[model samples]
Target: MEQHHPSLRSEALALLRSGVTNREVAEKLGVPRGTVGWWLHEDRKARGVVVAERPHNCPRCLSLPINRPAYAYLLGLYLGDGHIVAKGKQNHLSIYCCDGWPGLIDDAEDTMRKVLTGTNTGRRAKIGCTEVKSYSKHWTCLFPQHGPGMKHQRRIELSDWQQEIADGFPWELVRGLIHSDGCRFTNWTTRMVGGKRKRYEYPRYYFTNKSDDIRKIFTDTLDRLGVEWRTLARGSDPYNISIARRPSVALMDAHIGPKY
Candidate 1:
């Protein structure tokens, strides 16, 4: 950085405080653009004005084009297992992935970056899982479901734009939801077939969520995709949505297999 006269900085600050753009001030004063920006920043700091970082390029707010499929998938993951923390100096969207599935962790981070282009993302290791986090103040703007309580305890509903994306990319949403809160496993039973004992294996998919609204969202999407799902009661609460029909299971297998 080149040193400049104190009087030049004073003149730059005067221009900046008077609504002159940094570039314009730099151009009029023959100062470098970077120096003008730095001076303006310093002036604001000295005057007790908090200099916020450049605003994130929010697709919804800016009417900017976004990767809809990626957004759809990330939304599902968020509804199923991710959350946003917006507080003093602590704002981010975090999706937790089981450590056993390193690939899913990577995919979660990648999908977040894709949706929030050029955003900063990092990971934190937790017991039995890793939290893939994207730092942004606009996460709540993107995911309106973020609120003051647990998702299951709150009413979760997507906005019109989100519903449109989910409709367009139903499979991706299903994949993300399954990767977060659903699982595929094989159930075996022995049966007598023509006087011979035979073992039969049935592969099924299950999505478990305590939130009625989230469950409805999942089931409604399944209905739109022509895939059948049934509710299975666990103890007193029916938190499991099971896809056991051969055709439905096959559809799920074709679209969203076991997590990698």
Candidate 2:
């Protein structure tokens, strides 16, 4: 067996005692599975937690009570461009994002793994789209918005736990939505100032989604953060939201700058 750090052993044991399985504890703590198994076996000998006594299902796969920034971000991504499908005892969660964006795929994978403690991988699905997929037994519980049809056709609402997370860290939710389906860039204009023409460029954030409910969730979170936004054509079309002012832009910069 490879020599391992004592901290890794401690982390693995902690996670295992907190209900994570040996496999999940190893991957989560960046330790070898065999090491985790040995550690847990030793712990079981000490505390009497045995394989036969273990739940047939993995506790980490069950309903997660984490309401941190990562969970809020994943919730936003799901609302924007993710899909959760029930597949045999697990819910497969996949979020499609722009492949050209900087560090988006990497960030999504990291955030999901941190929040759900699950194995995740990203793949190129199309010309400009990448999908980050992970399996968890509690995805449906986390994102109750998942349904038979499209998000717009169905009501997109947050669960009570999701509401708690969004209310606390609305910025993370905004970041995930913007990273997945929105963009921020400089908008320049030229006008007469002091009887002379001057050019100025300002940063603005734009979020466009086909689902009104999703857009409302984004805007509502922004509202909670006191971020200003304008709706161009309400109920007319998607991509109708824009935040083009200074203070709002500055706030967003502090919270949800370019993911990289």
The C-alpha local distance difference test score for the whole of candidate 2 amounts to 0.79
Looking at candidate 1, what is the lDDT of residue 10?
91
> lDDT tens digits, residues 152-198, model 1?
99889989989999999999999999999999999889999999999
Q: List runs of model 1 lying over 4 Å from the truth.
A: 1-47
Q: Using alpha carbons, what is the TM-score of model 1?
A: 0.80
User: Clashing residue pairs, candidate 2?
Assistant: none
Off by over 4 Å in 2: 1-64, 120-125
Pairs of residues at least 3 apart in sequence or in different chains that clash in candidate 1: none
Say what the RMSD of model 2 is: 10.4
> What is candidate 2's lDDT per residue for 8-126, written digit by digit as tens?
78878888889888888877777788888889879889987555432322323554356488887887788878898797565678888777764888777787777766454556577
Highest lDDT model number: 1
